[model samples]
Target: MEKPSPSRRAFLGLSAASLAGLSGCLGSLSTETDETPGGNTSDTDPNDGNETDSDNETHEEPTEPPGLPEGGAVMFVYDDGPMEDYTQALPAHRTFDAPATVGIVSEWIGREDYQSSGCMDIEHLEELVDAGWEIASHTSEHTTLGTFELVEDAAPGAERIYPEEIRHGYHRGKTIELTSDEHTFTRAVADYGSDDTGGYIAVDEPIEEACLAGETIIRYPAEKIREAMGDSKHALEGMGFEVETLLAPYDNFDDYSRKFASEYYSGVANARHGKRVNDPEGFDPYRTRRDYFIEYTDRESVKRDLDEIAERGALGVLGAHTFKEEVTEDRIRETLSWVDEREITVMTLREAIARYADR
Candidate 1:
């Protein structure tokens, strides 16, 4: 479920504006923050170098070995809402005996509105996991990482949502209102802070420490990226799902966020804006690429993408959402059948990571 790409004119405007704001603060932005393994709590010290080398060592990503024996690996990833899991993907997986991964926004599990006809609740997610589908984090809310505040705490008795405060993407800062102690949603509020420029900054410096100020149009500080990644992982595991992978909203990643992902998750299934054709010999686990299944006009076009993956001996990840009209149940069935006919290896993100990523 990627939002349409910004127009070239709009993108240029944003880039220009961002550069003007980032130029002056570039040097000061590299200060360090202390971090425990999973939580986002931090205390910044401009001179601290204690964690600098360790952080650098942590994000020096290595390429994964080609894990498939014959044809390249093909992972069918269902992104965003979960209703498609029960109504569509599950049946296809069961029919084809395929294993796919579903990336879910953790807080939407049981809510009524978010559980509408096309969306799935917690029980439905559990069913998917029971049927052998890997459930990965699409974050607590599907907030656009570099452009918005990822999540904010909400009081139980108060409004369940605050649409205005939530920014930049489809699911904004969500309120975690779970009733049970077993499902505590931890918010590392202290781990992130806003600069005078209104950019949400990570408390921790990236392993590279290459000041992000003027590097990208938008930047998600290393700490906030960790909070979103760590919180989502904790929430899914708290609810009893085996979580290891992350699916970035809009297939977007900044270098800092990618580094944070490498630190927290076993693998990242989607990175870059769209339809990334990966090179197997030097595939990056943190920035694993994918193409949208719905974007192809015909079966032949999809097969061509698959053929490319096979030719390159790459781990090709394909993304889809059953809720969309273009991504129908019939389409999934057709795709799976085609995959079976092609002898392509279809595995969950977890399965791929176990076989391919450098642990």
Candidate 2:
């Protein structure tokens, strides 16, 4: 099946004739909108009252709340913490401004999958935390929690491991998606090896179950993500990190997913498909995006995305992963240098969340 791209009807997906038109009309004025629920951006906050508010409650056409933060905003959420993020990308973030949060997959932190085990070291994370980079949970494993049903034994402080499900090709099943039997969301921390503290949970542990406990924000690939985030907050705390924001898997969150995470993060939610619009010849850090500038996330497409945001008065967020050899490091550097030269705020995902709260 040809899955639709995030930017359907965008420049990237436009037909040859339409694309030519778009290219010609791509002057200073053109607009596009992506209001789809699953194009990687969603509101999954937990409604914890802290993260979410009915700020736009007025009946005046219910526009975005005024007195909010400036220009709404832009931010960066680095997902998965691949080593490249640490070695190749972080310095750029630092040069611009400290990032707000760095979501990490606990299981992949020190382990290698396909030899791309995260390049970030524990020390690097520690340093980042010291440098004001808020650390948040990206799940113990990079599993799509929503799709993977919790077994009976799942419980708090008790980590449980599901058998490998079939992967993409050749029917290598890794998990089986199903509805929750109990139908209540909760957290499980299998008390891995040591109940002492800061220890890894193992596969075999008493499965303790509860209604999805944790902080509100979450990101799972299943249909009902709220339930999957159950009690995940405390579970993450047990791992020695104060759990706050929960970025979506692949940065993919729909409105529901965003509602869940907002319960805790209580700020603007992060999305994968933010836009980038800067000077074509040069770049204004205020209006530029490294991912977009590097041509990694489709710059022209992003410019159009920006136009939509400007019209809607809604917040816009842009995420970036490491630019691989495929995209070329030189391009990445050029984008970063532009941000620094322009002195853009270059806020981190967490910072944006906090700012959104103020907004």
Candidate 3:
């Protein structure tokens, strides 16, 4: 069932000091306006329908896009809390006095297995928080929050079964539901496996009734989703860091996840993605958009998007996985330079919400 959406005041409850702090970081923005896109203005009078040669020649000066404090804003978000974020991306951003938002996987923090693979530890993340960075939740284990379907069938008491593994949504300890046209069975994942046969999930309890191979597998219930969202925020806050946002694991979430996220987070960075920028008027903090900057991403295309952002005075969000081989420090620095050259404001996702979102 869908849950009630929380109001911004109930969720953020920004105090006078908090607002002052935000204003200190991001100085005053221009008041909201009703200007059209491209800041174009029409000087022609509608009532005076008489057309003249001089009327065609007269042009109105362009103005700032509506709903921003001034010009466009960009937010750089690093996903997965990798060691490279602290080691590589931080220095690049520091060069231009820009702050970034990072989505942390709670279980991966300080875990030897993950640390060995170049994930960030608690100490590394602390340094980021100290440097004006925003720490957001990417969930406890980076579990996929979206639902997928099963590949094979099983009877009651069966503990293991095949699922469409390409989604990579299943994990041990996660509660899941198997739903068919006629019935729904909820079970906790005991283990996850992949081999020559493909990927499968091992449930803790035996299936109560027969389910076919094509049945749908729901990854989370409303209660569990709420638990995951709240627990991740609490875990980070428990570490003395302010966590007011979420970056959905695997950039995958549905209406249920969105609803629960608002209960615990002020905003979500990976809510959507594409070439478009967010409009501040009636902005939905939970549905903010972001574009990926992977190794294969085109530099020119990103520049064009930035151009549009500056021209329209909109909010542009860029997300990246800093740990990847091709996403080097130089590449990150170069992107920051682009935004710098355009004179666009770069702030953390949390700050953007505070500035642009309607409260």
Candidate 3 stretches with Cα past 4 Å from truth are 1-69, 115-117, 149-170, 190-199, 202-217, 274-276
TM-score for candidate 1, please give it: 0.62
lDDT string for model 1 (1-359, tens) is: 11112341122222212323332333233323111112222333347735444453333221222224356678888887657668877887888767688888887775556534646877888888776678889987675564322233333332222222223323233222111222323221223234343324232212221112222122334455667788888998998877777888766665646667766676788876566366666556676878777654567778887777666666778888677667777888888776677667776777666545531
**Each candidate: RMSD to true structure?**
19.2, 17.8, 11.2
- Give the Å shift of residue 248 in candidate 2: 0.7
TM-score against native, each model: 0.62, 0.48, 0.73
Kindly report which residue stretches of model 2 are placed more than 4 angstroms away from their true locations once superposed.
Answer: 1-72, 98-100, 114-119, 145-236, 255-296, 299-315, 327-330, 340-343
Give the range where candidate 2 is weakest over 10 consecutive residues by summed lDDT: 163-172
Per-residue error for 133 in candidate 3, Å, reads 1.0
Could you give candidate 3's per-residue lDDT for residues 290-335 as a string of tens digits?
8876555788888987887787778888988887778889999998
Q: CA lDDT, every prediction?
A: 0.58, 0.42, 0.72
TM-score leaderboard ranking = 3, 1, 2
Better by lDDT, candidate 2 or 1: 1
lDDT of 2 by residue, 1-359 (tens): 01123443122222223333333443333223322212211233545534334676322111121122222334455666777666666665555443545667665565555245444656777767665566666655554532222223334554433322211111122222222434433332322232333222243333344323221222233433443353444555665655555655543444445555545543322432344422222211122232333435564565555554444433445555553444334544555444333334444444433323321
